[model samples]
Target: MTNMMIYNELTAICGENNVFIDEPMSHHTLTKIGGKADVFVTPQTYEQVADVVRLNANYHLPFMLLGNGSNMIVKDGGVRGLVMYMSHLSSVRVEGTQLTAQGGAGIIHAAQIALEHSLTGLEFACGIPGSVGGAMVMNAGAYGGEVKDVIDHVKAVTPTGDLVILNKEDLALDYRTSIIGKKHYIVLEAVFKLEKGDAAEIKEKMADLTYRRESKQPLEYPSVGSVFKRPPGYFAGKLIQDSGLQGKGVGGAEVSTKHAGFIVNKNNATAADYIATIDMVRETVKQTFGVELELEAKIVGEDLTETAD
Candidate 1:
């Protein structure tokens, strides 16, 4: 089938307004640097999401799932197939001591709900900028807490378009990674088991974490949070700082002066600029300390240089 046929089919499943062609990836990401996606669709319901997946599978079309777009980088040549945004599926509710949240719900909202219910466990997530599904896929955590520590189960749609529920163990969650990250599973919802606590204490803890994040992170510019994973026994930021790489850049992308961990779009940066800056940082760090740095962000789409040739 041609791209138009796929677009028509998607429009039929989701309303015409929910489907877009040649959508700019920059508009969807936190870094505000990317090319375009050939197709973009937002499904209002879980069934609609599953149906899209099924249709894509049937057509042998390549598709990618996106959450809050916090930790993603789309290349300059753009994504070839469909990019499904789950933002429309956001919903959150509480059941006793458990918080059940839809995949598209902002992860911080779960912490807010926990605060409302005087739940103690989710205070650590009060400042994470990603969606619940993204958090589950990456085992996102902060201030000594991780998603795996609280998540009881996760519901997702497999690549084959089957909806399946996975317990905590089945997720195979680790530091900044999970089985979902490795597989073609689209997270639908997550259930977190929390404990009742004093609302005042929970609020205080959340406030402190929020303050710390604001004070330390370079939130003034566009960035995908931390760029590199913490290398064992060493911090990525500290290494960059010590290497005198802070305030350095490639094109419009710069190593944040306020926080060495972040690569910000200080000027009008392209995805290629960000990639180049990242390469520079990794190479410099490797040359200086002999430590290989690994990216924490998910980079997708095509390389413009390769495509141009």
Candidate 2:
């Protein structure tokens, strides 16, 4: 299918206002880096998302599902085909002690809702910037709490554009990964189970976690949160610090001085610079401790042929 034909079809479905051509990815990601996407799509409903997925399949065009782009880095060469942003679908509701949230709802927003209802389980996610769907896909967690602990089930559209409900057990949530992510399913909504708790205590706990995050993380700079996953026996940040890689940088990308786990855009950094900085840290850590540091932040799109600074 030709580009014009696909564009016309997508416009017919979501309207021209929802579709963008050559959209800059830098504007979407937290790192403020990356090139452009050939086609950017924003679907406001679950049916729209399913339709978009089916359209991409029919056109033989590849598509990427994106949330708020918190833990992802798009490369300098950008992305081909469709890049769907799900933020417009955000909606949250509560019933009794259960909370159901649309995929695009921010984790922080969901946590706040839980707080308002005196729900106790989601306080740990109060500081997460990712959408609830993204958190479910990655089993995102912090402060000794994980999404898997409270997730009751999730509704998602498969890559083939079929919507299905999966229980928490079927999700196979582990440290930073899930069946949804592995299968490239587009999450529509998630149901979380929580207990009624003292609102005051929940607020206090959320406040403490937020303070720790802000004080330890390089929140002032643009970054994709933690760059590397925690190795089995050691923390990524401590290892990087031990390797003498603190404050090291390539171009405008720097290993955060405040926290070695983060690679921050201290200056106006390119995607290439961020990638190079990650590589440098990985290699240094590998040589110093004989540990292969895997990345927590997923890299997507294409790379540009440019000299690294």
Candidate 3:
């Protein structure tokens, strides 16, 4: 579709405040990186988002459903479709021991809401940076707990743009993957099952987790958390450190001096720099350890330069 047509149709479907033409993708991402999208939409409600999706599908135009941009990297060339930010979809409610939360809600927010009601089980999500949809889609976990442990059911929009509900068993949750990919469902809301617990104890666990994160991670720097996935029997950081690659980088993107697993922006790094650093890490680790290092975070869009220094 033409730019004018895309704008006209989107504006007609959603109000002016809900859409942007050629929105800069960097501002929407957690890594403070990347380029721009042809168009961006922040639908005011789930129905509005669904309407946008249905309309796009009808036209056969490209569209990408975005969460918090926690687990993705939009490339320097940007995305070639309508990028939707679901932050405004956030809502949370409690029904007895179950918490029903919108996908846009962060897991930490859910954990806090659970803590307020003295609900346990979400204490493991204390510092997870992704949204509930992000956490659910990837089964995001930390400190020995995962989404599969508490999720009950999910309401979502399927690939064909129809809404559907799936029980916990249907998600096929595993290490950082879900049925959302195979089933192509865009999560709208999720219900979590939790047990009653002491509010003080729950807070204590969250605090402890927060302390550990602050002390161990290079939180002061801009990064995407762990850059590489753990190999079968070896941690990504340990292998990187053993291979003598800590603090190495391409341009301003460097493997953090404080933590080997993090590739950080040391001096205004670009998306190219980040990509270069990642490539070097992958190649170097494979050469040194004889094991391929897989990326935990998703890299999207296209590199403006085929070769970035």
lDDT of 1 by residue, 89-154 (tens): 889999899999999999999899999999889999999999999999899999999999899999
- Clash pairs, candidate 1, are none
lDDT digits (tens) for residues 120-182 of candidate 2: 999999999899989988899999999999999999999878999999889999999999999
What local distance difference test score does each model get? 0.93, 0.92, 0.86
Model 3 stretches astray by more than 4 angstroms: 305-309
TM-score pick, better of 1 and 3: 1
* Model 2 misplacement above 4 A: 306-309
The number of residue pairs in model 1 that clash at the backbone is 0
lDDT minimum window of 10 residues, candidate 2: 300-309
Best-to-worst order by lDDT is 1, 2, 3
- State the lDDT of candidate 3 residue by residue for 177-202, as single tens digits: 89986675788999999999999999
Give the count of colliding residue pairs in each prediction: 0, 0, 0
| lDDT, residue 245, candidate 3 | 87
